[model samples]
Target: MGQQTRAHLTGRKIYGCGRCGTHLTTVEALLSKRFTGKFGQATLFYSVVNVLEGPPEDRRMTTGLHTVVDLRCLKCETYLGWKYIKSFEQSEKYKENCFLLERALLQTIEPGLELEGAEDPISREGNDSSTASNLQEEDDDDDDDDGDDEDE
Candidate 1:
């Protein structure tokens, strides 16, 4: 499972599935959608936790809890999306003061809709235009050759 820093939700449907009409509110449903190419796959990972005091490197304790999610293909195990869970201390004066973090972060990576053995739109357009121009140039060359033959 590879980790991506960016988030993507291209194929992700904000509503339910069109085929089975399954609601995508739960993590399991989301995972299933990801695996089936409905929402697209992405690797979710825990990076770090930040406290109000400062980062752990600044003499502050980095005891915050963190969680990560990995989006992978069920069949081929390809990484796709990332989810993070973080918690921090609510106060500094309270020695034993800590609360469950109420915040959640989600990230997704979509590599664009892929079709087997088919080129993307941008590539296809360039190829078509180039081929057309090349054919035109060849026609011009043939015309010049014919004119030279006549002169000879």
Candidate 2:
């Protein structure tokens, strides 16, 4: 769940998974997208939330795999994406401190106070929103391999 403004939707703040919005650590969490082939090369995107335990499961695989852990919606268990547990590259180890959010799964939250009686806005489902489909991953990783290794 996150927000990265594209051309048409300029200056808009977005959030994802309405049920888990409260679980979000920051609206401005750094976003990173990369094909580590560890999580799925199609481009894994997620937002940095907080430090998490590097659980001792799903810990072995291809060389240079980012030691990342899967992050899920704390309430409903939706697979939001992964967070950096550690990195394999020493030069880029700072990435071990961010989250890579899936842009498609995200929705936008109004930047300021909600109008009276109005429900907090949620984006259309990823399958239905053209605007959302067009959203792109803006930030790049510091280039050391991203973090987190998935564990159930």
List ranges where model 2 is wrong by over 4 Å.
Answer: 1-12, 18-27, 31-63, 113-126, 129-131, 137-152
lDDT of 1 by residue, 22-108 (tens): 211212122111011123222111221111221222122243333333333222233323333232445322212211111111111
Q: Tell me the tens digit of each residue's lDDT in model 2 across 82-120.
A: 665766656546556456555444444444523222232
User: Evaluated with TM-score, which candidate comes out highest?
Assistant: 2
Task: State the weakest 10-residue window (summed lDDT) of model 1.
Answer: 100-109
- Cα distance off (Å), candidate 1, residue 89: 6.7
Off by over 4 Å in 1: 1-65, 89-152
TM-score of each: 0.19, 0.50
Among these predictions, the greatest lDDT belongs to 2
